[model samples]
Target: MPNKRPITSEDLFKISNVGEAQISPCNGKFVFVKTTIDEDQEYRSHLHFQRFDETSSVQWTFGKVRDHSPCFSPDGKKLAFVSNRSGKSQIWVISTEGGEPQQVTQSKNGASNPVWAPCGTQLLFKTSLKLDQDESVFDQEEKKKEKKKSEPLVVNRLKYKSDGAGFHNETYQQLALINIETNEITELTSGRFSYEPSSWSPDGKSIALSANLTDDADYQIVSDLYLLNVETKELTLLTDHNGVYTNPTWSPDGKTIACFGNEREYLGATINQIYTIDIHTKKKKCITETWDVHITDAAISDMRSGHPNPGPIWSNDGKTLYFTGSENGNTSLYAIDENHEITPIFAEEGHVYGYTFDEDRKFAIIGLSDASNPGDLYKIVLGEKKKTRLTYINEAFLSEVHLSIPEPITAKASDGWEVHGWVMKPHGFEEGKKYPMILEIHGGPHAMYANSFFHELQLLAAQGYVVLYTNPRGSHGYGQKFVNACRGDYGGKDYEDLMAAVDFVLENFDYIDQDRLGVTGGSYGGFMTNWIVGHTNRFKAAVTQRSISNWTSFYGVSDIGYFFTKWEIGACFQEDPEKLWYHSPLRYVKNIETPLLILHGENDYRCPIEQAEQLYIALKHQKKDTMFVRFPESNHELSRSGPPHLRIERLNHIVNWFNEKL
Candidate 1:
């Protein structure tokens, strides 16, 4: 590690992301998606295949387009994947022996999420279609028509617009079946509801899926598991309509279905648990009822993309199930038996975001990352602690750079509750040398800051700044009570936890300069930054990105604000305006003394740019030190997946602000 240079913002282009790995049924070959930024600054992803006996992986498909979601046939003779090589995303089929891939579907709206049937003769895919539109219409060629004048967008539903996908249309995600041999297509189900297909029955007579069939789906946020008869088209509801359910996997014998979901006991704060239902008796039992961790990949990092949940994958014998669980600061793989006994398979101090098991369930391909590594695939045996590294995608980049490895730290709140987090020392650090420190907060208020590789944090550490990030009360990975503790108390105990984290770090680490402290976060973290500056002037600088300032107006403008406000803040503007106003950071703007920097995305519908605008203007009117920076055509995910140049610009702005003010 001697004579190595620190990582810079431009190093983002050198990291290659590997995810969505699938092991072939025969256990001889594995395919995964490797994403990299092209010279045009646009993302290019393709399918990569490697044999278990081979020493290196080979690119299966060559293109500048995106090709992902690769699935193998039951016999492992052919591969079906979704690709945009035909101008739009569609299913393509190719033999395992390597040859030209044939286009399977030519739908007008494009097709995705392809799954091979048990017989390997047909494929199940998803497409967008109007409620009354026939499936055949998608197969027809586009006809030229005269251009018309622009029309206004007529809105009726409360959920009209989304963040990444602008406005809502009349189209709904519908399921369909296509025969690969004849290229014949058949529509499965149709209506206003959207169905997400999970697995097919062993006998191939039915399919397990989840959908919200309620009449008022716009208001009622709930989904139920169902069994769709492949031939008869009869739908059978498996769960009550009071909870949210998804990722339904059918048992091998077809007598039971396993899924991950939770009742609305705590609304959006409820943690997901695994459940098994008897198909014949309609009796459901919570398998992971005693397991308190969230049953999904909730780790937040900027170095990963397209990581699937790796839901409950059942063993071939139907006696065991494998899935990923988030706990503490690690997302690990676990297994549950028929007796409801749980065991950790690969519980390491890293993020296992994506994984796949072979047909025999003896080995698995796991995608893992930690503080210093971007990510790579590992092959692990079922009952062993040993693992063999498969892919070294970031080996060359890591060899030339010195990345800070974060040390795990915890702090005790005033109330005696322990808070967990990690601290990254400045690059090229020496003993007895004081350095400026920056407190980095993660969004999701529901998402956890885990042992994952983060480009932003590394860049900050490389800039000679000690970075402190913690999982406060609202973050997942902890038990249910801890995650729900901040629901109704937005800036209450959560704020205390953050302040305590900073105090703990200063007390333990003597090299950190107390006078040169800085704080920055995005989304919910942004809100907390605004709250921190308004309530306390302990930090010399602060940066809030895509943040919320006024809750009353936020409830009307944000995409999920109509219900997210009431669910998180425990109040609505109409019913309890005073309570909502109390949590608004803008209310205490008069007390803010720290130099504040506001960063926002103009097209962000989650925490709209208006939130930043209000905060910047109020601080300006009061003659406070504040500056506003906006990125055009960027959504709420600008920090993670926005344009490459803009993401670098955002990083530069943060580094510059702290260097100048702190």
Candidate 2:
């Protein structure tokens, strides 16, 4: 292969996407954010609105401003959103019918996830509380004095390292109530940690939110549902126990609150189920189980879907709730009646990540995607069952690009457990020639890899390689047992599943060169790649990103380390360090023969840099084949949400390494 042109930052930024979905209170109108690149190579996003009658969609907010999280007033007269039009992100409001959006609150720190109060006289949102200015002189003097000594840099946890947005302040996101009449803002909840405000009761007496208020354990940041009395400012914890709880939506009458979250298990997998809590009794019931399916993953990329929460829409009478799930391959919308009987509202072969219902429930605004399309918006008219395209947002951009389709394939593990995988044959593949193959693994071992569109996998296929990605044990879309089976058994059966996937591909795809096989993955996928390289030299090369090499060391560094380690390994660090060491891939580092590439973000609290450093140092000490790549200003989310330039650079590096070594 010939050396390609050096990668540039502009190439990376060009691949970023802009997506937002909002609804009007009257269910008569809808709004969504449209993002694009300008002539100056700057990204811009704005709000667009469309009436239920399809009176034509029109851009609402203007200028070079990037506005998102649009919500309509109860009276359907005003719209609220977060915009940086004034040089900094602030809350603003505008009329739904027409008129300039009015700036609500101004602050150097940004405000986000705005929600209209039921009374329409006020709005509730979260804003970062700014810290005092930092004195760089003191830090410089300290560095100079310590130049001769080897001392570790100490940072304040509250004002620690941030990504493209620079260092953070001693700030935490707090719930704020803004009076639309006087533009006065009142802080409701304040603390070192942040609170995600989801919704307000229909009567505006209480605000429902999710936060990690109790149990100061460093590793467990799982949020639980809470209700704050608006008048007294009293906070009440609603749901308890080990599971993560968020996305609280108030029932029409304010008697019950609906939220989505997952329960932690002994295995690495989590059961993301939907629950309904009775405010009066504080009793909870898992509503999703009635359908025999779970709302495992929610697809909203913005805080608008209420981060870490279930973005559920209540029926007109408030007797039913509707959410999205993947029970039969593709994601679909399911409705749970008041009686708790769940049934599919709509099922399609394509993916339906989420839906926004109009006030009347007559129309549903949805975000959808297929094997070919990354994402698109649709208006599904109830009763009539008509699907209308709201915007051809990415058509013009994607039309010029060549995309590949994912072909489903089956593999059987050594234990005879059937594994599911998707293979992307090299684009423009030659019929008779054998091509190098790359096995891609997904993170969350619990997360499934379906026949959906994958940008990275497709790019590799386009570059002339057969990309094979699989969802072994612990992956979703399968039942609970298959996923939980991987618990306390890290490199065991799950590893065998991956090996079977590779063998199945080699046997079914005759054109694949067995000698030129490679593997790469991020997080859990990265963990598996590490295990594979150590256990067998089948792969000619490998790239592990933000991966864990040693379970013992990993149990101390990651954000979810304590609970996560115990859950996955079936024992806490103090109880069974030996078991953790036994499952750790780094334990067999000396046995690894394949050349390896290690990548990690400098500030990944989930899987800290030390994990990568340990592997790199071990391999280098052994004088084995290896290389390490580090992203200075990145977190565990580098692969998905890092700066455009860095993400592309990261991908290119993987491609470069595999191209040269395989």
Candidate 3:
């Protein structure tokens, strides 16, 4: 093979990657979803399998349609997974030895997360059905009638539209079981509320699930755990409080259940911790309470697919537990014993996004991505913490292209808080020459900018821009105190932390051109970019994506706004209108002079397009150099999981804007 050319947005089309691994019951084989873009320019995912003793992997399914969520039966002979080949997503089955897959269900609303029964006689899956309907009567033809009708959307629910899922329908997700032999489907749970089936009990007589059954479910973000009897469909509450909870994994003995959740003491800013509940006494204990670590992995990077929580994987002993978490810009596997002593099992300079353990639970197949690798499977010794590379998904492409190595840097903020960041040098760089720099900020304000592979940053570096990203005070990977710092303070010290990073880079890195500096960010990072340009003209250009410009409107329009505003910004419209304006970037828009490029998603309900609209309108009225590019039909996740061509266009917009201005 010859050396490949520098990576372009189009190069993404040729790349094929794998994720969402599932171990077979025999512990010797595993299956994962290998995703790639076809000629239609749409993402096509197919299942691929590899045995522990095998040297290479074999494709299990062939299709341009998506085939994901692989689940191996108890005996390891049959594999059940969700696929959209027959139309809407539904459960499909195939023999592990190699055979044609059989479509099991034809639910009108579609099915997902198929989990096999303990005896392997049936499979339990989730599907969205009409509120009052009890049978699987909504078939394919009925769906056509519903889709053909030109009816106005009627809404009365407190929460209506979602970003990607779109406007609220009367239907809600419920758990259902399908007998494998008879192909008989039975609705296990039903109500106006939605239910997410997590894990089945050892005996398979009951299942653990989570749902928010509160009167004002939309206003309340917290969910309670429940145990649903497989036979009688009886619901038993496992937890009750004003806190968010999910990912329930049962113990081997079925006496205790391990789960992940947060008390919401500080609301959305609260760190997610691990908990355990006794099935008999119903007593729940916060296992990782005293620990300062955020049990949930919050690392941010572009080279990833879906961030599903691979919840607490219990060892065969059931006394030991393992899970993945983010800390100090790296996400790795961690272990927690019966005594609640947490230890980093596989901490390294990369991101461990997903993993699946063998039947013995001695080893795991890990999905790893870092600065050098896009993503690949690695076999890891759980107890020894040793890693062996299994697959080279992007090795060939990477060997040809020059990927910039981001040198990690650290500095003290204006408030004396330590700020962690990295500076990616230009590709094929000469130490003596100067280069333009771009300060990249990540969203989630609570999300950690980690040592992970990012397509956008690499593209910019390939274009000769020194890209710098940092984990400011509000970002995760740090302790609870640090992550909660920016809450209620919004643009205060958090802004200082980011600026300190830029200052450290300019002062320490001699090759970076000071006058040619630029800044760009998305979501919360976008809010900071808008605020940064408003406050200082230090940067020559700025790009804000899916950003928030007005706190007043963000409080009501966003999906999590009603309470998130009260938690993050400290007030609502009526409680503190003046304070909301005080922190909003729109209020300080008059002071901006930097050439700004506003990138936004029209369907973005998280920040809303109004944020970009108002900012661009204000700048245009003042005759400032500003342009707003709206990506139609895209939500907040336009850069990550949006249309492939549109994602390329977004990258082009960012590169061309900086190339032109900086």
Candidate 4:
């Protein structure tokens, strides 16, 4: 009998920290969404809160509902957030001091990003609306089959498919104002495009928002800031030009608005800088010009609900400003004084997701984490060298496991371009014997793979595979030039950068069996895997998930295909079909010699399943070794937040594929 590889389900349910958390304004209280995998293996999220005084601390709120985005009212007496408690996600409100939450807005459409009005009398939210327009593609196909069939008409602006979220039949999102006192909901903006309600003005008469009502492509090109009048139901565009603007936050006095803007260029070449626009004169000033590193998802990091007007808090008198900044892979909190001098607020080593200040601005509530800690809340006061630990959600769970330390390694690319990467040797690695290796790639030729707690990476290490992954060109965390260098030039320099990372590992690590190398990546990473298999026969096995195989067909099928092809290649498909084909992995499938494993969710809207089908068919036709694994009811987020049983099944499938081939 052959020796079987050992496997267990413990790898499937390890503890993980939730991504987003928010704080309360009126008092010394805070709430965060905590995530965990249940016995059934389903990813569940709930709202967890902590209230403190000199005497004692107490925990509040528990339910099976997936509640998230808990923001308190201006009075700090009530909390508003989104929850799927009623089978569908909706906005709800509850008292922060303890009381049953009342269902605030009940609509068939899902609502998110709930912000309380400055007066505390209303709530502003963004939700997708249904409009009467055209028949669905399915309806059209059905009509062809049954001539007499009657179908319903639908019009949606947000028609683009998302990898994690399936076909959204909801178009343009509109802002809605719900009066807390009257329980009346009024649609604020209605159009073909979408607008995100960012924050309310200080006087509560206007709102600062980012939207694209011009066209469908406008949403993709650039977003601009706008001032929306609540009483008059009028909107005035604030910023002029081709800049991409988002996360518009009103200054405490309502005279100025702060937002993050990006200049649209090639793939991930956008440079996001913090800017403050004067509302009265329409004058804009770039606040963090020198700190030009791209900002991810702008937020008033220092403001919490009910504490003040929930926008950027004016230093009790509106002088100094506090915000989050990221530089060279370090995310820290900083304060910009009235003199525009930037100073580090806290000497910390992890990502800061949120923060809020007290009345005196001397103390702050910060949500932070390091490469080791998943995430925890902390209380930081000025002049204090150490932060006070607040929450301990995953402390007990993480203490039991053996964690891998990912060490950063830099290597020169095939073309002499420098590439940055990190490697994790197998947990409890042995000294002499060579171990199999897995080269993991991150998606978002634009996103950077940080040294953070990744469940899958940890599991691979635990399974005795030395995992080597790199932030190739076009990934953030590096400077703009490095990321932009890959734009309009995919599959060229980026591929070489990845190959260099692998070569660096082989040259540096003595315990790596070069012949037993395996490769895998999702999305763009998946595309690279397909590219690698066709270009080299070195890898023993490969897995491509949610990948793009044929750029020709992909331009028509993928949601962002039309815009993304141009963004990456610098030309639309009509203008440069040859360029798209030249970069496609499907073009070289006949030369692929590695045993390839293809995995994709059945309902992935981002990288449609047809791409997977085309690649699998081509490999099979070429007489190459391959297998296709599809999850029925999953989407792009399957690996991270899919159904419990299915997530485990997906991991088992990956392990099975590599085990058999390697």
List, residue by residue over 58-132, the lDDT tens digit for candidate 1: 998987898989999999999999999988888999898899888988888888889889999999999877543
Give the per-residue Cα lDDT of candidate 1 at 200: 93
| Candidate 2 deviation (Cα RMSD) | 5.5
228-288 per-residue lDDT for model 4 (tens digits) = 9999989898887467787777766778887767656443477666677889899888776
Q: Number of clashing residue pairs in every model?
A: 0, 3, 0, 8
**Pairing residues by index, what is the TM-score of model 2?**
0.88
For model 1, how many clashes? 0
lDDT of each: 0.91, 0.75, 0.87, 0.73
Query: Which lDDT tens digits does candidate 3 get at residues 51-76?
Result: 87775789888877899889999999
lDDT of 2 at 331: 74
Kindly report which residue stretches of model 1 are placed more than 4 angstroms away from their true locations once superposed: 131-137, 141-148
RMSD of each: 1.5, 5.5, 1.7, 5.8
Q: Stretches of candidate 4 above 4 Å error?
A: 1-20, 52-59, 133-165, 168-170, 215-220, 265-267, 297-317, 338-340, 356-360, 382-385
How do all the candidates rank in terms of TM-score, highest first?
1, 3, 4, 2
